[model samples]
Target: MAAELRLLLLLVCWTALASSRCEFPAIFNFGDSNSDTGGLSASFGEAVPPNGESFFHGPAGRFCDGRLVIDFIAQHSGLPYLNAYLDSVGSNFSHGANFATAGSTILRQNTTLFQSGFSPFSLDVQSWQFNQFKTRGGVAYGKGGVYRELLPKQQVFSKALYTFDIGQNDLTSGLFRNLSIDEVKAYIPDALAQFSDVVKGIYDQGGRSFWIHNTGPFGCLAYVLERLPVLASQIDQAGCATPFNELAQFFNEKLNQTVVRLRKHFPHAVFTYVDVYSVKYELISQAKKNGFGNPLRACCGHGGKYNYNMNLGCGGKKKVAGRQVLVGSSCADPWRYVNWDGVHYTQAGNKFVFDHIVDGKFSDPPRPLRLACHKHI
Candidate 1:
């Protein structure tokens, strides 16, 4: 009886120790403009001024006036902000790298960036880049000098947190292609299949923790609202386009189901399907209550019902009263508005989302980010 009791105690202790919170040494991210740090900018010049002005104080390759949610995630993990995997100048890969780019999609598009304004570096390409980084980083780390200081250790690949925030562009691409809502909805499974493949690829590389964010409420975005003229009757109570939001919800539902399927496939891996759509929609719906205003308008664009012009980006100039293209300007208070440039969120909005999600209430398994490695029942 004494021996049995000792064994039982040992098992309990072991279980407690084994199930403790995960200590992720690094984070490997893949996504679109929502989580992009600098991939698009590095490949296609700077993000322009007025962007990165709030926090970074200059053009820093980010679409927002300040940091993004991925930036907050890195800071919270006690690691430096991830360098863009494409950023060749003065990049430090000691902790991790971001492969997200503006206008990226889960499924690769057959169009060019100049033609459609979509990135060629889709999710699969990002995954390929990560593989290269891991493989090359190992070679460099083995050199044992400046290389060791600049790159991550070989073991960080398996122990790092893998975050994904793509899929919004996948929806938008279909819209731009003039596909109907049902048509866009029809292709979600394929996009999600590609997404799952990427996740599985990481798992194959020994990545065990996954954090995936669903697409946000694109219906509330100024770019979508102005570019796509919807019928007045189709507007929701929240003043958002109903068709687009419904499609986003459908994509999110299918994405959640995909995560469930992925969990079964990789028993050793822990998948956290974050419901960012709900959080974003809630914020937009109750913007005043959340201390934000003009949730649907862009803070840094001009000449539109929603203060957005597709041809004129945040820093792009537009002629006013036949004068020089100087009417385009940013809002005086970016923190007061939710939409940054009619596409991405402002730093304050990103901070709000980070605050709500870090505690894991927005996650499927209801476990904090620190405990994301543990599989829940």
Candidate 2:
């Protein structure tokens, strides 16, 4: 009897220790181009240059020069490079899978007939990632076969964190395609409603934790600052594009409100709002401090009237009438430039954003559903 009691006590102690140190088993990510890792490249077979060239020395399909904010977060958390959930090329899921795609928006109406560059992931497509996991033996890698068997039986969904960074592309395509800033702002509430539906679907599927990001400052993008038509008739030469910024602020405020309501609806879910606007603004304001001289200068582009050619994306080979032209230009050093290809960032810039998220610099105002998953983490 004495020996049996000692064994029982030891077992109970071990269980407590293990639970205290339990780490998040997986990170399931969903967002737009800002968080995509070669998904669009795999889907399109086109190169976007100097893209992923800084760190990888070759195009790895990211929209930026090197790593993105997603990669940095994974790294800081001791996770490996996030695999594209669509990548049939690999079977590693030890870290997590990225479901984000370039040109994707949280809102469906954000899609327009006149402009079709936007390839935002629909909610249906986002759910497809779960189906992919089943094909991968119903388990994330590095967790062993025992966990695989347990995954289906246990509440494995509770041990994972879902990181979402998106919604910028919606406004981008809207404004550039000729919609006025005020026009786009008016559609934001409806767009957010659809976004909430997608989140609710995840909730029904047992997703209790969410890290969501709002849109960045669109008026400050190198592409907008340089190529945007000068509305000198409205705003003067200060170059801030006041009308455009006003719309961005309005969208961000509504997004915060949505997050708050989501928290209340699902008391068990933890929703964290990533303040991308403030993070990006901080970097742009301190560009000189970060060794980036001009935050609005695109690192990859030709020296045309607006420092860009519509025919050439960052990594594409410029051509005119079936004849190749070397019109695309690369920066001397991408590290010194924040904007990678007029719309994205350098690897360094992404790192800064990641640090802020992990540090919890802007998780305030308490969105109702956002606090659920945090208790376990």
Best by lDDT: 1
Return the number of clashes found in candidate 2: 11
lDDT computed for candidate 1 = 0.88
| Residue lDDT tens for model 2, 1-377 | 99667555644554444434435566778888788886777776635566678887787778888999888767755677787766656536555677777777766644533368777465446656664564454535346665543233235566677787777776776787688777788788877887888788778777777888888877777567665655776442334556666677788889899988998898888778868788877788777876676777778876654355555757556568999865666788878877778778878888877766554545542222213244322
Candidate 2 C-alpha error for residue 334, in Å: 0.9
Candidate 1 clash figure, as a count: 1
Q: Candidate 1: lDDT of 364?
A: 80
lDDT of 1 by residue, 183-209 (tens): 988899999999999998889988999
lDDT of each: 0.88, 0.69
Lowest summed lDDT across 10 adjacent residues in model 1 is found at: 10-19
Q: TM-scores, in order shown?
A: 0.93, 0.81
The residue ranges of model 1 lying beyond 4 angstroms of the native Cα positions read 1-19, 318-325
Which residue pairs does candidate 1 place in steric collision? 318-325
